[model samples]
Target: MKKYIQSYLGLHLIFLIIAMILFLPLLLNGELVTWRDSQFHIARFHELIMAQQNGHFFPDIIKYSGTNSWGYGLNFFYPTYLFYPLIFLWRLTKLPVTSILIFDIIVVYFALWSNFAIVYKITSKIKLAFTFALTYVLTAAIGNAILDNVAVVRIAYMTQYASNIVILLAPVVVLSFYNIIFLHDNRTWLRAAIYSSFAVMLSIPTTLGIVLTVLCMVVVAYFKRQLSINNMNQLLRSVLLTLGLSAAFVFPFIEQRLANNWANLPNNPDLFGANFSTVLMRIFNLSNVLSLLIIGLTALLIFYKKFNYVYKILGLSYIVALLFLYSNLFPWYLFNRELSGALQMTYRWHFMPAILGSLFVAFAVTDLMKIKQKMLPIVSVMLIYLSFNGMMLNTVAKIAMLMVLIMQRTILLHLTRIILKPIHCLA
Candidate 1:
């Protein structure tokens, strides 16, 4: 009990420091940081409010363009349940948009904390958990989809999309994979099922991304004789539950696809056209040092040793991630019309592999430390720095840094209530 207490409080203290640093710029500033999609997200939030006020009772379609011709569009099909809690808050109290925005940021903090918990559960190591969570929270999650598209999800204040990645997407992939691979007891299946059902609401693209990654993982684990019938059963149950829960949104998507609503969705060469033969060169030349280190460490688990099924699964997952990341390199478009169109934007599947890569790195780092490798801490630090603010060449990066420095020094700025509210909640 004492040890657990110390660990929990210590985690909160660490989290507090990081949170303060992250919030410092916003605290000093008088306005919100409107990144690429930030302003558009704010408009969507207002549209959500409008839909709710009309007594729609948790609307599926959010049509703000007033263009009935856009025909219910993404607002109807796309998932926005991540914002539902804010909607509930609006109903309970007349909270203004600024307050809601602040809460959105706070929710992001909470979700990142949850991410740490997932890592801790996997590795059973404190430092490893903190490092993984810190690396992910501070950095751009992997270069999922495209590097620039990363900002649309992880940053730029698209709260729901961001929440989907770190909060729901990360946990769903890692937790379910761990449970399926290690735990054989029936006692845990019910809890797993409920979680699987609930979290599938994050979004279809991300859900499918994880699902596909796990499917490949399951096959790999089984062929290697690491997974038994019971383990496969557990995995299947969770997957079925996820599909069942997401059917509300997913079925509609399937129907539209069947009607060829996506027939015109082209596999644009400019967007994803990279040859498979060039991936090796890209890895050597253009990959992040952190990701390279991650792949190296995990690969060592497979090549340098034998029968390390855990690392084997992770190794296969890394390959799976790369495959989806560069899916346009394949000839899938020549056959399977539905699949080709559904997977037209293969980079979207990068979400699952990103979480998998994070897990592999976290696990690999912890394992290396166990072996007392030299300079490991320095390596981890370098990776942490690189993972941050994905696009370094952009003007937004310069402006964001300038804003943070300005706000960090302006400690006595005119913002007591905004800062104090979260502090009070933390206390």
Candidate 2:
């Protein structure tokens, strides 16, 4: 036992150190970095605190919240299972906002640690695992989807929404589904089911993501001829377990929405008449150069003569994920019209590529590092470019900047090598 613990101690220590560094502002400054939906989420946390104090452990209506204090059913409509830890911390500390902030930092750490541990479990390479984990956690910042100054821009700001939970558990779901389907690992299906349940409990957008992620995994398994009766049975067991586990939220949410005639929430999808360029822009902003690297790696893994089963699965999953991302652009929607309405924007599918693409880049970069050390200069330039190019910039501007970046001597040379001998570069 002692030997086992010592062997894994480095990962734990690295997680803690990086977490503290990332969360320094929230901890030392004693404040949250406010952004889109921050106020609404803070109020949700406050309602939880209020409900607990009023002796309503699981209040259907938060009488202390809503317009004119008429009692809001926010808790009834949205699952708060993910926030129980925050509530517990609030009870212990008696500091409502502080407790929420602390819990936010904790969740960030959990997200980082989970991604790191899972990649390591699959690859058994500490450097590769840490690179993937760190980049995945900070993808938003790396892509300039959030602020440039902050290292963890999205995480620093978006702590209030349960969407964070969806992001946190996405990698786990992907990996478990891969294990159950491709490896015939029946034991992992239950784990996948439980995490999928947790993910779906959050909201419609999250449920869509979890369901689609599993579907993509299964589809890829089938495409590769890895799908089997046992795989199907394991998947069935996973679905049943997921439904049973999520019933607490599923049943009540359905009941309340139906009883109150709130079933038809406005979807208001913005992609109805969006042109090709517009859709491309959305995908481009989804992860910037990370998306390019993923596309490159996935192609190599899928088409290369020497097949890599693990990466091929990841590649197929990314391809399927792209279909969903582009589904909104189609004349007829791919998902149920009603369900598609739940996603205000089609880019909600970004979570899928975010996880898979980061893993792809991790595999690519780690291999490149081993094979040709000289390519490090181009990788550095691309990383620098990603940091400076904000997501809000126009598509043309981003492309222009990228073209300029590619014109650099080192990057230009690397691009040539990549085009000429992509397999050699990756392998």
Candidate 3:
């Protein structure tokens, strides 16, 4: 009990330090207030608060062009979905929107911490799990998304942040789903259903990614004869429950959007003449040292025969599919022009894959470390090469430095243990 309390306190201290480090710059520079994305969300929250005060439920029509439109126009306030809890706080206490903004940032960090705890549960390595979680939060995808949001002042695009929050929950959702499908744990199925439902509610694109990943897992399970009839039944039940819960929110939204001719409607063609090459370039352009680390580590794992060939192949296939989706391929291809038109610019759709790549790297790194061989130098060189890439260059550098610091600490701890052994015997 005492050890548990000490560990809890230690984690809290670590989180506090990390939060301060990430938050200090925004606080000191006063950029937090002026950040364009921040202003837009704050504005949307105020609008919602005002509507609530006037005895209206949440406003269906968010003014995008200084006028409220019902169907066709973008609802810029959708990103504020998670902030529904904070809405109550605003009503009860009448706190300034800025205060809520600060609070939300803290919430995001806490969400991140929770995500770290989940990863640790799976990996059973606090350091590696925390490293993976930190990488996810501090990656260039997040930094760039925030920077763009601040620069663009488009609240509608806050979907990026929403997607990020969903990503933080993904490990837990995936693990739960795996347990339910493979182990047939009834309680696990219920929990997984709830988590999956929440994930689907958060972002459709992310939900689609999760579904695709599960499909891939299912195929692998089938080929390996790892799935039995009972397991399949439990998996189906979990998925059905998740889908049913999600349909409550999803159906109405989809129907409304469809009726109103939503932007990026299905069956659209490539209006911008975008080809596979352009999409590929976008993928390469977004690639960073961390991304390279994931790729390299994944390759090394396969080469060393650490993972089964099928699992390794599936991992690689998933990465490729992610890249394809990010690129102007089938489904995303159809909507590329429409989304670009709505946003008034072309942003790399590859951002999610880049973020997911970190997890692949984490899994690979954990596997590699377990093998008794010289792998550090190979990873180090790859990191150096990746750091040379120009995208989110500074953040990538920080990540690389953090990894190095961690490795150095491990080495020092080992050496200290070795040096102390002889002295203890002599004493």
lDDT of each: 0.53, 0.61, 0.53
Clashes of each: 1, 1, 2
Q: Between prediction 1 and prediction 2, which has the larger TM-score?
A: 2
Which residue pairs show collisions in model 2?
267-341
Model 2: per-residue Cα lDDT over 1-427, one tens digit each: 2232235676576556555655565666677767756776767667777878888776666566542132323444356767788888887897866776667567667777777766666667865666677666656221223423223445456532666556665777778787777777666677678778877766556667667767877888789898999889888988899989988777766676667633333354554234565445434443455555666555554454333676777766665555545544455344447554355445544667677767766776666655545443455345434432321222544465455455556777988887889677778
Best by TM-score: 2
Q: Which stretches of candidate 3 lie over 4 Å from their true place?
A: 1-9, 33-40, 63-67, 70-81, 89-97, 121-125, 140-159, 182-188, 219-225, 240-289, 295-319, 328-356, 364-427
Candidate 3: residue 320 lDDT (0-100)? 70
- lDDT value for model 3: 0.53
Lowest lDDT sum, 10 consecutive residues, model 2, at 141-150
Candidate 3 — worst ten consecutive residues by lDDT sum? 147-156
The collision pairs in model 1 are: 139-387
Best by lDDT: 2
